[model samples]
Target: MSAHQTSSPAAEAGDPPPVPEATRPVRARRLPPLRRGLLVPAALPIAVGLWIASLPRVNVDAMGDLGLLQVLPVTYFAALGLLAVGFLAVLREPRVRQPWAAGYVLALITVIHATPSALYPALRYAWAWKHVAVVDAMLRHDGAVPHSGTLDIYNQWPGFFQLNAAVLRVTGLHSVLGFASWYPLLANLLLVGPLLLLYRSVTTDRRLVWGGVWLYFSVSWVGQDYFSPQAFAHLLYVTVLALVLRRLADRRRAAAAGTPSARRPGAFVLVVVLIAAIVCSHQLTPLMLITTLLLLAIPRRNRRVVLPVLGVAVGLTFLWDSTVARPYVSTHLSDLIGALATPDRNATSGLAGLGSAAPGQVFASWVDRSLTATVFLLALVAVVRHRWVRRTGLPLMLLAPLVMLPSNNYGGEMIFRVYLFALPAAAFLVATLLVPPWPHRRWRAYASGLVAAVLLGGLLFGYYAKENMNRFTAEEAAATRFVTSVAPPGSRIVSVTSSLPGGELGYDTHERLVLAQDPLDQRRLLLTDPLAVLQSTMDDPRITGPTYVILTRAQEAESRLTGVFPVGTVGSVRAALDTSTLFQRLYDGPDAAVYRYIGPGARPSPPGSVQP
Candidate 1:
């Protein structure tokens, strides 16, 4: 028979001929998943490096914009676009012991999120100053300070500050400032891998797990992840939740096998201790975390973890508040009770209070709401449409943080934070829309992956765009440094609001805050009706000592955008200061100004104050 002819009897009987061995297409063994997706992820580092290198070390631009989005080099967007490419490419990888593509995608997500911290010349946010001051105090005093009735919360939650002090002490960096500026980037980078561990516990689908993690980072517009106790505690919180989920899965398997409970009691104790640590470290995170844990355990009938953890949290909260935070706790107890008592009112206030403030703020509020609602809507659709019963704890976890919403206003951001806590689960559910564990057609899979990317990128853009005006500036930081260094201790420094002058510094001793919001404190100045507040503070005899009034570019932006001060009010105040002889211009930087009131009968400070 010819080479192309049938060689067997079966082929000869009206059967197709078998092709010669040499003619057959060589079977191409597919490349391993890691190497298949390796090009993009590997190039991702190069692209990020180039992007960061090309980016001019940014301080806030003249307009007081962190200028993150506006001044970002083209490479910045190119890097983000490349990351999205790598993410989509990874989705095509087959499920195996490890989805290597997911790892690549995770790395990219972190690099993108950490960019602001990496690009900035100095630490930007105002709260970070307070945190730095607290750590400075800890390093100076050798330990936590006792209560200062109405000052910073460091007196109450000193663990994070103490930890920062320890880091400074160990690194001999002099101040956490060096670390603080880059802390957000570092915190975000650290958060990525561990978050995957938590997601893995909640879902077996590798795609869903990766997508959920990606989604969480993409929509992180709340900016609560700044270098603060909340950020630190949140990292711990994710770790604790992941551990509990892992253990619960293991214990269930053991139970099914009729094996004796192995170290279940020990695990319970460990979780309780972790909860205690969280309680000590953050004011609100522990409560949110506990609510989540209890919700998880209650539905699963797993009492061991929640029972002891909740008990420990309660006792620690009470003991700590009753002793260390006594003045604060006693003063706010009734108010806390009142807020918690009318949760419906508080919930509305928390979620809707900031929406009407400014055009930019309104846009931000809508973007945030839309991002959350989109993910949640996706999750709900997945829940209703998917026929297979996913036996994950995510459903119940979604309801848990809602229970914490009644706790307090948390300065009108309580709901924002609650959504943040629920994001992992919501992201998981959103991923479920595309994450079918079983294999499917390539086109369908790729289409879903593209959809996921679009959803994520849109949310991320929303997250970044909304903060166009709020990024703190370098000049404000300089003014803060100068004031903190030059101002005589026990001197009163009044500010319109905390958004500028980085009011967080010298909060306790070197300076006293007379904010309009704090009527109880005589020194607390007002942001609104600048002239009236000024005249009142200056004319009042109690303010005999010299007082400095500050106005910074960032504060002006904040006041304008958030409507904290009326439009052009910052300039109006400054103009008033410039015209009035009563207030002497002590030191004026391009972006920040310091004025000392030399009213009649006020003793003059030594001439020539220090300048930054």
Candidate 2:
């Protein structure tokens, strides 16, 4: 029969003819419910158990140049591997389960971030300790810390501290130290919600959405998720952007439906409140938020939703900077101007040379660079190959922060900040590449798992490579506390480096003199005749009170890691003080020592009569 005569009745009724068997679409295979249920449920607990089993084996003292990576047991990596494999397996299923994917992401965050809290006796990172001190000062001064000296920046943008103070008051917790150790884990968990919101706004595919979230945590090696104002402000910043992006998506839908956009005053108010919170809490994040919002608004279709948020961010930032943060801005205005004047320098300032870093640290730094480049490369490929990513404006969002790189060096951290702000978009783009819109082959799952493992390795190396400098010993804490407790107000507290935990405990009461910041000649003097440098600093007429010199293991690690001083500068200086009769040994411990500079004419204390 002729082809037309052989046509089906359905075709005659204007329905399409039956597809040939060769061209028929095949249903993707899915894992059986029973198998999936058992496997996915068991994966998380096993991974958690492995991680827990691995922590005790980590000897923080014996950690080498690679930091925690050197000390972490093989089981820890096994845990990470198991999670990566399980996550990829789940994603490979024809029907991705949200709960299983989210569970794996949460597990990844916990495994990565909770390690420090579990292993370290005290909080990690000196800056976190300093922030705790800021909270203490705020509580003492009733929401305002006066005479904050170098740390006055915290007081200028006191919103974060004030919030912590209020929390302390409400919870009756003496200090943030009580929970600061776990802040990294909690902050990362808090980020997941907004990330889901942001990713969902752009795409409905669960695999892409959850894969991006997993990738985000996997490569977020910046270590900015610690207990700091930046961490808190970043959470709020992400939330604001997610809400704004959702609004943008809504506007597009409304226009498509031929309906004028509806104004949701509540949502707008919420965005303003979050923007205000972000501006008041952190300095850099507000600028980033404003830049991103302005870029989103550049598309005429998005201006109606994005412009208002951008305006609010700008106005709040201006009001806070001109009013509350005026002191810091005015004082640093020239430096900021100088940074802006030299755009090339601003762009390259954050890139530190590896000449001075330890051999292992140099390797870790290269790993970090490689990981960053890999992510950018994947995103670039996605942009070139996938029209959906470009159509959705994700590339624009990802590249928006590049404009800020030449604006200010941000104390040589602008490059890092740009990467951080660009990370969300980059993660989504990378996810599109790994988990494409169309299904292809089993090799895709293997490729995803392989890439994830590489990124995770990079994350581990990059994030933990400098833990020797970031981690503080109990002795270091105790010695710092002892000095702060005994040293009189206005006394000069000196350290070879600022890596001592609790170094800023009495920031308002004591004067700080970090020898690391000393002039080149003075640092050289410190290397040769530490006595003269200590004596001169102690005898400075402006320092009318006693002077305490603190040397810590972390300080030595920092010196060696950054080449701020000679590799054994701390040890040599400690040795000099130990043998010298001019300086009194106030307190001595294995990991740290405290020395007081008495006048040259004064006799030393009797042997074994050192103060505690």
Candidate 3:
């Protein structure tokens, strides 16, 4: 050896001490089998981006997804397939790719959520149009008008409107309507942080957390994701839970460190502020918070933190409803109390009231029910089979929301809403069996990925299936606009169902009533079986008025799909209108027809206004 040369000491001494191949620096060799799995997540975003670019834009005439299925390009399905494949590929990868994989899944969710909005010229749903009107009213008046004929006491729950109005003011966005189509995408995206926080708090498994979050987005079908107060409230709900869970996790660490007294009052304060916001934002969410808190408190360890939060939730709900929204509460109180009288009846009515619905809607509804059942059932099996899921109290969280079901139909959907609330925990439980414990063999990892992909495919279908049945068209909106512009305020707006394009803001200037909404006729409405019900309601002095009787494509679809008329037919109603001299056409368009009902003793309508 040369005097200055630094040689391997073992070699110099003739001692052959070997270096392990597995322990070498990562860059010294090509990626391991597991690290190479990152290629899937790496390629996911690009494939998804290209697929989105290839899909057709939203068709403006359709209210939501109605008629959308026809125009959607093959690339739409390709995107869905790509997401499924990416999710599986990521799940199959070792820990090295999970962080990047999580990001990819979130990005995919954002794109999928915003698909309709990105594709459409106008907002997807008619209700979104009315939401803008509410914000406009709030902005112009700087306050809400109670029971404004079209908006109901939504003026009372004006926190969402207020928030949106503030955004409009700052961003100079012309209307909430334009952004409403993508509300589901954006609201869920915001929820990712809280959801991940909560899921991560309960479990150490990253795959389980990610899977549950994905499952939540997949199965959420309340349509509350549209630009509404409920969407904001849901975000608050998850965030509050996340904070609580984070606090619980902290306490666990502190106890282990012998510093259990460490405090974070700021977190509690933030939670209270959010609870107050929830109270003001929606009628039901505050109660839901209380229910969730109660569920958490049942486990003795959580009682201290949960009890105070529960009190705050109840107090805020009562305070807001009793004082600021007193009128709305009082008006709806009887209905609420009445609903509570027979819990079984209320729950059954709520569930049965969902109806098979129109054919497409029926398909969607069944898919929703099946998906929900499968999740709960899978959760049950996971809890029984896996100690990790059971000991963590995942099952308790899943059952907590069912308490809302016995209270009332909650506008004929309390049960479904409960399912929505239970979904997050349910998904976590479902993931227990699907994702294996870490440090497994490659074939096992691949198997887990394939299983997850199959489950994900089911989930994706449930998420987007509602698009076809819920959409409306721009022509319907134009006709509605003409009616509102020309017709006198407080004109009774008549429709067979509240499915018309203009009905969203009907409470603004018109006394609107859907014949199907008549308390006396719910049975017939549910069956869609009143052979001549429309004609009778129109002729009835008690129901009929000098009103604008408008029909839209959505109404026809609603009546047919829901079987809201005899044999689920809208023909009877349309035929009656065509033959009747009482209604003079006010506006006619491809998807909408507006009629001014000339009362029995009224003078003739202006000539040339009636359409054949």
Candidate 4:
């Protein structure tokens, strides 16, 4: 039968005739709620982070008295106003925007609370807590050193310290405890959003993202260390990677053979800015990011690869040398390296330990080796499994943890700060595994619901967990608090000949500490040479007069300085010595007894002086 002449199916056999295919219309995909809600919580974190980064102005001299930081009321009010506007703008309906909005509120609380605490140790006196006491004492007497010493203990990360001080100034908060109190909250705030973003990027399943962030922050390192710039660096590292991934996805879409739209010039600018931010903040992050670009680019066309790669590499290399590397290479190599290595049974070691091959054999041996091994295997898997990661736009699955090898498991804890970029990447892989896929048509509520359960749990555990380095022990917190109490302004204290400041029960020396001198000689200096405490103090022309010194019980024998000259002691110190041996065993008395040296006026006249 001719097609048109054929009897209708319904007429011929009681079946209805089929409708023409051309008449059927396609239904458009409904957007996912999680993706839609993402931009909501991000505003506050972005502003806070920018605020933190902007505090260190090139011309600003913030190291003096921090009277400038006391204006938190003004900032808080302004921030609150912005937050209210943002809230009202986004919160036209709570059911639609509340989850993301809630995330922002928490983030603000975390950052505002956490940064001040972290800044206290860095801004109040010097760039580091371990060396604060020594630097404070020296700075109080004189600003310059006397002898030709090989190193500058006061110099760690001047830019970073300066930035910290500026935060104190802008916030108008000066007291050390006051600043320190901001740490926990800020640390949590900075950490939470990136983690949430990471989770969202990997899986539309909110539960997985939430769970992963919770797990990530639950580790103690994320909390107590929250007060540190490293955490911010970690946040930045992840954010840049996220931005890169987003750009790459956009690039892929634009480059697709059938796409009508050309590549956005704005996209390239964003990529460059992100690369610049990572490099300006820290070296290893840019290095890791560049490595990711290279690995990811190997299969891509040259036109796509050349510019961003060059921009990131060249920009990062320049910034690394100018900001972090060149300055540190000069004065801090030996001490920094020593801190990077593990000490022996007595806890004193040499710079020889710094460059040693196996610094990870110390405290982080297991984690160092484990992370390295995992990254190595994942890198291979990344190459083999590259298509999966590529489609997902997440090469940090391998790059983040891999680059950490240079610093991980090695010397001082400071290296951890450098390696923080690895964490967000690690979190990416973890959240990806935990969350499930979300297609355009279907909303996966179970997955979304789980987001809060696991992540919040992980965050809580990470924030408060006993073993995680993020949270401080009572002793550790107490020690840091003590440092805050006594820290001086415009001082560069080098923790030398003593472990008293960084912690209460000093544990000899931490694996990451480099003493004022050879760590191996640290005990010897304390036990035999009372004057070792005075080396930085005496040798540096900066110490023209008297500076307060803290000597532990281990150094009591040398305390008298030849057992002949009467050692001047403060009343607070005398009371402390009289009160408890705990102070004697772990620390010196009167906060090790504050002393006022009247110089030649108080001590015997210099040899040339006639008796008055």
TM-score against truth, every candidate: 0.84, 0.93, 0.84, 0.51
Please give the distance, in angstroms, between residue 469's alpha carbon in candidate 1 and its true position after superposition.
4.9
Q: Give me the overall lDDT of model 2.
A: 0.83
- What is each predicted model's overall lDDT from 0 to 1? 0.64, 0.83, 0.66, 0.39
Q: Residue 386 of candidate 3: its Cα lDDT?
A: 58
Pairs that collide in candidate 2 are none
Indicate the worst ten consecutive residues by lDDT in candidate 2. Answer: 14-23
Q: Which RMSD does model 3 reach against the true structure?
A: 9.0
Who wins the TM-score comparison? 2
lDDT of 3 by residue, 165-217 (tens): 89988999877776677788888888888888888777545666677776666
Q: Which ten residues in a row have the lowest lDDT in candidate 3?
A: 15-24
Tens digits of per-residue lDDT for model 4, 1-612: 211112333223211122221222445654445345454565566656554653442112121111122223344334533443343324322233446555545644544444444433332212224323222323333332232132232232233334454555567654333444454465556656655654454433333344355335422233334344444455565665565554444444444434544556675676676555555444345555665555555544432634465566677667666655575555556854654354341122111242322222222333343443343343355334323333343453455344444433333343443235455555445433433322212233344334423333333222222111122223333434443344343222333333343431111111212243445455345434444333434355443333333333212211222121123222323443344322222222322322222233244334223111
For residues 486-585, write the lDDT of model 1, one tens digit per residue: 6665566777667653564655554555353556333223334455577666555544355788877666666666655556666778888888766777
Q: Model 4: what TM-score?
A: 0.51
| lDDT top scorer | 2
Clash pairs (backbone) in predicted model 1: 514-523, 514-524, 514-525, 515-524, 515-525, 516-525
List CA RMSD, all candidates.
9.3, 5.9, 9.0, 15.0
Our tally of clashes for model 1 stands at 6
